[model samples]
Target chain A: MERWIISFCIIAIEVWGAVYFFDIFMERKRKGWLDKGRYMILYLATVLVALLDMYQDTMVIKVLVAVLELMAFCAVFYKAELKQCIFFSMLNYSLLFLTDIFSLLIENILNSKDELYALENPFWLVPMKMVRVFLLIVLRWIWKGKNSYGALSYKEWRKFGMVPVFTFVSMLVMYFCYSGEKKVQAAYLFLSAGLIAMNFLVMVLMQDILEKGELLRESALTDQKKESQLSHYRDMQALYERQGRKMHDYKNQIRTIQVLLKEGDTQAAAGLAERLTESIFVEMSAVNTNHAVVNAVLNQKFHVARGQGISMIFRVGDMSGMRLDGEETVILLSNLLDNAIHECVKVAGLGRKAVINIKLVEEGGKLIFSVKNPVAKKVQVADSIVLDSGGGMHGVGLMNVKAVVDKYGGDFAISCDQEKFQAVVML
Target chain B: MKIAICDDREDDRGALKALLEAYGQDFEIREYGSGESLCKDMDYIRECGIVFLDINMDGMDGLEVARQIKSECPKVHIVLVTAYVNYALDGYKVKASRFLLKDDLEQTLQECMDDILREILQEERVMEFGFVEGNVRLKVDDIIYIETNKHKNVFYTQEQTFNIYKKMDELEEDLKEMGFVRIHQSFLINMKYIERISSYVMVLTTGKEISVPKSRYSEVKRQYTLFKGVE
Candidate 1:
């Protein structure tokens, strides 16, 4: 096993170098390189090697490495645009299978190590290696154009991958038959074919399923974040609005006091109105929240509720001491409210109107927030991203909710019965 | 000062109300929801020395209302308010006091209102006419030919051509004297900027060639001619 480490290290370096060299070329070729993570996988190849080696020789290490490889496998499978995955992850894999064939051939031809060395001589691989590199360059062209870098279904992977798997298996079986190594030839062939097929098939299916699970976990998190942001924005909006209303209120009070003084009741009403204005000022200043844009968005959302004739109540929490920035607060609140408002506005046909209730409270080391609106229609779960598992304005605002939830240590969930569309999040 | 307003759209009527509240304040404001609203009630608008009416409306248009107002309420001044300026020539028939564009509300409206009020409301002065030296000593209204050369405003009347150094926009502003508008960036002729406008070319009155920018073609024509309907 230790003797294999040197070759593994050399292969690891070669694979990583080629991957990064291509990555640099891609980055130089495209402007939207940050959002385009096609080249990012090449870097991840290095990460895979190091991550796999983090725990070595133990079953736990083996499992962890396999899991890491599985993640990379999922990335390669789903990211269909970078068609170079075969030349990259499965790089020496095909060659190793071919070597299995060659080793059998040499064992029959000559018993010495020199014959094996001749087979591995790099000069002998002109056609195969050239085909691989040419394929890589073509795939790079596809990746550079960034056309559907990752949107492959399990079916698509199987369709494209069958030829390589069959060729490799044929060569391996021929080698095994020649090497006199058939124990359960039928079972071996079945299991080998099945394992390879399942490796590709199950990986795609599980990647889709796991990505969805991670997505759900993520969405649950962002839902909570969105709630917190909604409350934060709402609280800030309420503060600003109250301050604005106070200006009108305080001015009228002063006018009343002046009238009272003019009417010779200066001793009576002036004191009372003056005290009232002071109390109003105290209330306004106490709500010294830190956000203007979020306040505006929440205020607009509230106005939307008003225009829709829905009874939307906001329970604004004290977000003054909290650390969510203004822009994030705005984005989260806007998206959450937009989704909730859409649902709220849809609440009809039940011979009843809609009601949207927002509550924000901090409890037990978590920011607990809830937005419950009566939905007229039954809630249906959205379509899962079977191929491109990460994002888009897909299925629901679940991706957005998940992204934001993951930002903060939070949780998001929605339970919709016939009458109520309820979403609760904790951050 | 008195001014009458006419429009046919409920939303446009509301928008005009808001615009007037924001811009027009001085003269006692008379808002007629339609031309007939004021046409049926001309006696009510008789004191409104200036009439502002729209070209396209559900009922009677500004032209009919203006013709009627000129005959029925003789002393009441007529100012045409329209999205299209081509109504200006029809305005000449009823002796319209001024042409105000509704689209250019802030600058054009403010200036037009000021001019209308100055000449008719306070009754301080009337329209300013220009004198161009030529064989006939033509008034600016008669001589529709003015050409620009290097930095000078060259005059081409029915009889003579004289050059003067004046930029187009400035000259157009000053030529409130002769009701001149900056129709083209380079040419500032009086309401007489076009010789003949067609599917392609706008032949200038001066025999000079100019491209009528698509955005300004309808506006310039409406401001200068009667515009019965589009060709």
Candidate 2:
């Protein structure tokens, strides 16, 4: 009865260490006593299987049942996807296997013979189990709050899962082939260390892949937004052309009225003049500049700003000397105005009338563009570029603007205070 | 100040003259019926501070007349007036300071005159300081930046640097309205000369780079952007 009780205590410690190890990377699904109760059930089942294996001497059945119980425990108590649960379960079980192998290797080095005899002796078994559990807890503490793998998708989890799965199978095979020979024991310790190193390498690689993927996705979204903005500007240009034709017709009608008044029909001439004036529709494309692209982009941004209840004031000088192509003009102006509008909307939300001031001028053979808007939060700028604090797509948009400015061998500067932010580009 | 209006139509010239008179500034106004007649008097063109030109003149069109005037007097502020919007692009080729549509001259004329007057004031404004060598007069627009070093303020321009015994705080107050910005404790820079800012460093058009402190970087950048927009 004493021996059975000792086995139960050792098994409880091992299961508890494994549960905490998996908890390092996985988030809990629910909180409170219900979650604790689920963990208790998992602990009890794992200990029961381990105790049964000790008496029955079936190592394969014991590891299989323990792995399934851990996986089921993760699915029930954690908020991870299926692949993530499976991957972490395999990783946890492999670490437990490694700790046991490490303790056995140490025992062999200390005794040099009678390894099976040591396994049956309570004095040896109790110390070995304590060492195994201590190693597990130490590892869990070192990786206490790290969740580097949390950002990855299920596909990535599946791909990276292979490493732990391979190590676990190899460990199982090594356990089955173990003979009390000194050569095999030495090989087992070296192989276990190699497997642990491999798992660490996989973690580093996963983090690198996550960062690169985020940047790639951001740039793709920026390009897509640019394309849509360009198309919308093109559509606005077509509308302006139609308006131009309508204005020409209105002019002809006015001339006809002038001729009618010259004749004896005064009432008809008055009626026609009044009707013509009433039919003339005034639209938002009132901005007229020397550059067609500038006019289009400004009008579109003006419409957007007005829709959001933000006022935009433009002081545009002659832009004929700007020397930029249509696409470059759209990219530069649209990005600047879009960012300004975004800041203005935030300011408007705070019960203040939001206003954006934009200026585009050609001075001394260079095109200067600037935008100023009120800011609700303090902005951070480094090396003259505004740093994105929220990790959003705003940073990517500014990067595109900077890229265009660099192409022209120009200058870009951003400045902000507690209540306002401004961006300026000279090309 | 001398203001000149050149147009082929008599009524159009009268319309511009009436608007100029309503501007409430004391000016000696001269009228030319054609572009050739305006270009004939070189002495009058040289002394004029601002010249208004009509683009669709009868002979030696406004653009050619503008090019000739710019070649002779590069400091003259040329205001180009046109009936159609297409001529504005051609006006830019001659380096016109402002563009006005004849259809809405009443609304745009006041703003144009305000800008031209402010620019002329900036061009004529000069400051005198007691330098270590002697007292020197310098154009406010020509100053690129000022660095405070060893209890002396050094003013850097395109041609030379002048050292004067003045505090930076006093100089910043005097030059703030004239497009100067205090980017650092030791540096007071002219916004017009700023080429770019990168990595906490402000690069001037004269190929000089000044490092900005991390604490003051954001405010400096914000002030620079606002200065560019206002200018």
Off by over 4 Å in 2: A1-328, A334-367, A370-423, B133-136, B157-161, B194-231
Residue B20 accuracy (lDDT) in model 1: 59
Model 2, residue B81: what's the lDDT?
84
Q: Worst 10-residue stretch by lDDT in candidate 1 chain A?
A: A382-391
RMSD of 2: 15.9
TM-score of 1: 0.30
Error of 1 at B210 (Å): 86
Model 2 residue pairs with clashes: A383-B199, A383-B200, A415-B221, A415-B222, A416-B222
What are the DockQ scores of the candidates, in order?
A: 0.00, 0.06
User: For this target, which candidate reaches the highest DockQ against the unseen true structure?
Assistant: 2
TM-score of each: 0.30, 0.49
* Best candidate according to TM-score: 2
lDDT of 1 by residue, A120-176 (tens): 444333332333344344434433332232334555555546644555556445533
